[model samples]
Target: MARRGKKKGRPISGWLVLDKPVGMGSTEAVSKIKWLFQAEKAGHAGTLDPLASGMLPIALGEATKTVPYVQDGAKVYRFTVAWGEERSTDDLEGPVTKSSDQRPAEADVLLLMPKYTGVIMQTPPQFSAIKIAGERAYDLARDGATVDIPAREVEIGRLDLIDHNADRTIFEVECGKGTYVRSLARDMGRDLGCFGHIAELRRIEVEPFTQEDFVTIAELETARFGGQGDERSDSADTVPVDFDAIDALLVDTSAALDCLPQIAISDDAATKIRLGNPVIIRGRDAPVEAEEACATARGKLVAIGAIEQGMFKPKRVFAG
Candidate 1:
């Protein structure tokens, strides 16, 4: 029999709310963090474009199982829309596609707010991550292919004007997952008789994470290598980092499951749940029915499952 190779990197697990900087894509950010921590596995809950900056929740090791919960949560963004010219990418990065001399009045912009609020249909930008027949929309656009992307429903919890000027307008929006801020800028521009594109954009909040929870890439680097920045390590393969300090920056894995119903179980029950077995939950106040629930033993998370007929059935178990 052949010997199996051992997995490399530490088995760290948790969520890291990264204050992602501009000019770095979400996948690149995750890869960098994974290298910084030397973790065996890592993934991001949602994608943030290179042009967008702010909260990007990263999951490492066992926490990756809880990604869907965080990804489905609401997002808050503060963006500035540049008026008079629309771009091919719906941002400053692309060539000008349309231009206008008219700028919308403050009253006119405010009047149109009601139309965008609540549930609305939105068409994603051509230069977006949306898949078109197994290919990215942006890929097709880059290949000079004209793809007719269909509009879809998205929820906007709140949309407010933060500041306005003759050439640009700043607005803060709280919207559901899959909502595109660039689309908002483009559509609003067309409606106002002015062409527009995203001049600047920053996401401040994602559900289950507060503004204060995010840590910058610089901060993570400093924590690992002691403020040396790029000169901290002589070699990328043999870089020494402060594991304790870097690990301290990670939030608990259960934090992402905050929205789900939580149930407490005994160690014995937890053992069974971890072994992929259902256990009967006791107590009169215990939940009898829940479509989605989290089970915790003592203080640590055990499994994500559902309660049916007073039994806790484990769907996904976490390693201790």
Candidate 2:
């Protein structure tokens, strides 16, 4: 098989849609997968809380450069909010700080959904990875220091009330980057005159990917070792990455740019791009439209570029 990148552990490059299990922090999951693949480098597009489970896109090697694209894409999450008790961390991790017996009627909850849709300001959970003065917010919170996280604007595409009972409600949300479901749940409860916190959370989709593309860690291990009958991950480490399987199980870097405008360039242009030289782009005797686009050569990604005066200037070049 052709090598896709230089090997720190091995020349692996692609994205893995992991159905991240609950209780495993995002960073820990990244490290475990990196160790499993013996990959040179790896990073997740977005962080899923330890209490949250489901689709976590793991980008490997050169694919890491495109993570911002995936992270900024629309995300779909299905979560459960249990009313009556407020937790310090916003989810189940923290101790109960406040409680109430009041619960909103189903109609009241439905009536409140519209207020959350569209653009809104959300305060992220204090027990979060966000940096504050060079240290993690969670670190400070765990150290018993008071941490006050500021609210920021975020866009919500859709919010659906999936199911509900006396003490809890299930909801599904489609939102953009920087939206915090934990904060949403907390605020919703507050608006309803009852305290609340996330009881269960799962990310069903991230833009360019859906639950249909998700793979569990065990399934990944099995695929790597050809999934020998009845064997599990304990024995997976003994087996090496099937170079043949890597291409099948892993998605290419181009998948990350699915939302970007695309412009195909000539081999000569691609060559010049790799050499850090600018080339004029032409589409059917006319200059390519748009200020930014992903440039490709012979169906393979070349670089992300900008157009100015009809010249395509490579901003970030991809190595073969």
Candidate 3:
């Protein structure tokens, strides 16, 4: 017999769309949520800089297993680029390294915006987490060592100039994973023949999750204690959380798997795949999705074989 008053065990799975406030690191937010829910497993998709704020999806329980799917999703951000100055950290947090006497008009920024769209080679800022020989580049830079990280290719699907004031310009960006908005601001300034840095940044969306689905830290804390009714706040600054909000943001791992061509299998084939075999993929399906499912199956996904003589012959198995 069970104890009458014993609390139920923690929920096995859920996704938290956090409207991260400024001044907290990504990991700190995850830790707080983990404590709040007492969840045994948790992880965030992409990391947001301490100076920035907005939608940060924290996966809990079995949802943590789907993080890679979310991580690979596209991101949208609204940021302010401050003209006439540049910073070491590429944001307001870093020391000013350069300043300009000239301020350009909105048209100048609009003209230069086109150059950033589409595929581009970008050199990440030195003050970044990118590793060089297993040592973080930022670590080396802070120690007064010179680190030259070669430029890599990244795609900027969309870059639009939203508004411009005398000293600051707001822009919206839709970019692939690994696209650094700080670096974009720095390079855009260079192209304009002026120095600049990101003054403010907020993620607007991360693929499936939008601004409408987010819940700020304050709201979350309030809800946890039942201080306020679970009604959605109407503040533009506040993202609402509801059933639809959760459903919209919660992307199943299989959706990512669907990106690849799927290979159907029999019970025997599934068992073989569970046993550990290299099943050759006939076409590109969601690699992360397949990998995730395989990991969930204790390292066995399914048996893959060629369809020959109107029959499926087991060729390779991805298994434990």
Candidate 4:
């Protein structure tokens, strides 16, 4: 469970490309950043486990509107499989459940790749965040319940072997939403007749944001107070808010809507869209035929909408 945030705070808005360090949960990271920025609202686009680290795009204030788009985008991960043992949770966090002395050759591991590639069915690890009847699956598993996670189809764009050794095999995979790399490692070991578990995992990319844009927590704090003189708050626990510095570190909300087709709307149209009304997209602004678009007015994002016979209807409107 995540800690509840304060109801009253500064209404800061924009995207923060965080280079999440290992051993920090995503929920805690959001809370820390929100407090550092003194933001009224904050949320993350994806949940990165504490054991794994890399790009974790945090949304402040109105930027939360774009979270769904980022979640649906493709993701890339690099992980290592430690063979000879399998954990109940499917990762290093879980207790060892099975083991085998047999090891599979690199060629044998490569041969199994095609079977798991493209669209395939996978059962999520028991110790996962997936909810079951309003309760988290991990909680259920910890309580000694047999969490029968169903097998569902997930998209795997690419899965390639980078390095292979007697005890560990390193690999990189590009996949879509709902695809669990832990499940892949577990299944791979089973296929090779040797038990295995994910030894280490790191996310290298998520759509609209990549490792190149990641900013470490220390880096963000440095940027916040680097040139602000000794203007620390009297409380010592609280940091003084610098709007100009915040605006510099944060990116516009439009940055996350890059996947959507862009459509430039008039100021009047933007106003109507904000009121939950449909606006007629101009001849040149809209794409030839797109179901959805990112409508902007003069350079500011207005709303994300659907195009029905050229009529752009607001689906998600941005208030900032």
Per-prediction TM-score: 0.95, 0.91, 0.73, 0.91
Tens digits of per-residue lDDT, candidate 1, 160-224, equal 99999899899999999999999999999999999889999999999989898999998888887
- Per-model lDDT: 0.92, 0.86, 0.72, 0.87
List, residue by residue over 188-228, the lDDT tens digit for candidate 4: 99999998999999998999788777788877666666745
What tens-digit string does per-residue lDDT give for candidate 2 at 1-320?
97687445866788988899998999999997787677889999999988899999999888898999999999999999999988989889889999999988899999999999999988888888878899899999999988877888999999999999999999999999989899998899899999899999999999999888888877766656566533436555454535566447777789999887888889988999989898998876545555678888888888987877788888899885
> Could you give the candidate ranking by TM-score, starting with the highest?
1, 2, 4, 3
Return whichever of 1 and 4 wins on lDDT: 1
Write the residue-wise lDDT of candidate 3 on 196-254 in tens digits.
99999999898767777787766665555445534434441233343242333333433
Q: Find the 10 residues in a row with the least total lDDT in model 3.
A: 291-300
Could you tell me which 10 consecutive residues in candidate 4 have the lowest summed lDDT? 228-237
Model 2 bad stretches (over 4 Å): 1-7, 228-241, 285-289
Using lDDT as the measure, the top candidate is: 1
Q: Rank the candidates by lDDT, best first.
A: 1, 4, 2, 3
Query: What TM-score should be assigned to candidate 3?
Result: 0.73
In model 4, the runs with Cα more than 4 Å from the true position are: 1-7, 227-241
Candidate 4: the clashing residue pairs are: none
| Residue 189 of model 4, lDDT score | 94
How many clashes in each structure?
Answer: 0, 0, 9, 0
